[model samples]
Target: MGSSVAGLIGWRRATRICKTFLFSLILTTASGAVAQADCRADQVELRWPGGQARFSVELADDEAERARGLMHRETMPRSAGMLFAYETPRRAQFWMKNTLIPLDMIFADQQGVVTRVHSNAIPQDTTVIDGGDGVQFVLEINGGLAKRLGITAGAELRHPKIASSLWACDVE
Candidate 1:
């Protein structure tokens, strides 16, 4: 009777462990699903020491889309922007060439941390604005917005396209 009772207790302990593992797995899966569902494709968020900002973004993810970026848009909303996601981190150089509106370029690394900011780029200036090396993302917003929002180096950028980043959709 004692041995059978011990066997029953062992079985109960094993069952409990199994149940816990299953619960944890389900929770993790649900969290991941929520992250994927909640990360809106049109939005990008940035967090700096002083505060945070959100932009409604148009993605320039392909060669054609990146090349044609904001070239002819006369007016853009104050909270609207364009996000350029590169296939890999590399030296990024941009020019005002055909871009119609003045812009502030925020350059970020593969970890989605801001590396450089070029402010108030003149419209159609055609000057190369270098973002240095290891730039994986570039955000273009209305001129002086970066300064106004206090976004600068070390700011964390969050977008689903960032994949692995300092701040990710899954985290918040």
Candidate 2:
């Protein structure tokens, strides 16, 4: 009787361990899938007078994400950028505090038209770079790319956020 009872306890213990392991595996797999989907690259296009440039940008639409924008990163690909979207049009300001790499900040309106461009912002500088009133979106790219590509104030930005408005996406 004693042996039978001990065997039963061991079996239950083993079952519980197996269950915990399986649960952990499932949770890890699900979290990986979610991260992969969220990190998928989105594209934005900038159209100027005689040239156009396309970039793969990560969206920073939420407060927490925007607050942590590109800080402490040692390097960023020239073709990649971060797009900050706002709920409404208002003046915007950006600083390079804690940012390890220099960047060019492009300020755009609600319609995705470029309103201002702050080029070669010094890294870790706290000075505010202001986007004039009615600015709704801000795109940050590697420093000097704006000048190299000839992106100016008149350039128009096209992304999903502005596609529903005046700058509609070419495709459905």
Candidate 3:
């Protein structure tokens, strides 16, 4: 009888240890995922009714970079984009010119709210694609991606530079 009681206690102790180990593992995994998903300076995140999306981005915050745009790039990664930042809200006009890949332009206002999405602008086309007035930021991605991802006029953009973002960046 004594031996049986010891065995039962040992089993209970092992079971408790197993449960504790599993719980710790779950917490660690959950926290790791959250940490990995933290916002990055070179990344932009957009959210809409359809949920959210992330893109690795190259910033065009200066005059020279914004003027050059995405010109001469034959290929861009699927989850990558160019983010154009303006010092203040103003009308933004874009033309394809020397750009090789078709693009989708997402224009946002001062609050990081998307104001327009121009889908599938023809590659190398010289026609101006006006992003309208009060545009503070623009995200250029591969053509047709905006429509496919449900990125629209009302979506919210989150980036480190968007100081008044409705969707704030965690890393900032």
CA displacement after TM-score superposition, residue 117 of candidate 2 (Å): 0.4
Q: Write the per-residue lDDT of candidate 3 for residues 89-144, one digit (tens) a residue.
A: 99999999999999999999988999999999999899999999999999999898
Show model 3 residue runs off by greater than 4 Å: 1-36
Residue pairs with backbone atoms closer than 3 Å in model 3 (clashes) = none
Q: What C-alpha lDDT, on a 0 to 100 scale, does residue 70 get in candidate 3?
A: 96
Model 2 regions lying over 4 Å from their true place: 1-41, 163-165
What TM-score would every model get versus the actual structure? 0.76, 0.74, 0.77
Regions of model 1 farther than 4 Å from truth: 1-37
| Per-residue lDDT of model 2, residues 90-153, tens digit only | 9898999999999999999988899899999999999999988998889999997788667889
Q: What TM-score should be assigned to candidate 1?
A: 0.76
Q: What is the lDDT of candidate 3?
A: 0.84
- What would the C-alpha RMSD of candidate 2 be, to one decimal place? 16.4
Q: For residue 144, give model 3's deviation from the true position in Å.
A: 0.4
Candidate 3, run of 10 with poorest lDDT: 26-35
All candidates' lDDT scores?
0.84, 0.79, 0.84
Q: What is the lDDT of residue 136 in candidate 3?
A: 97
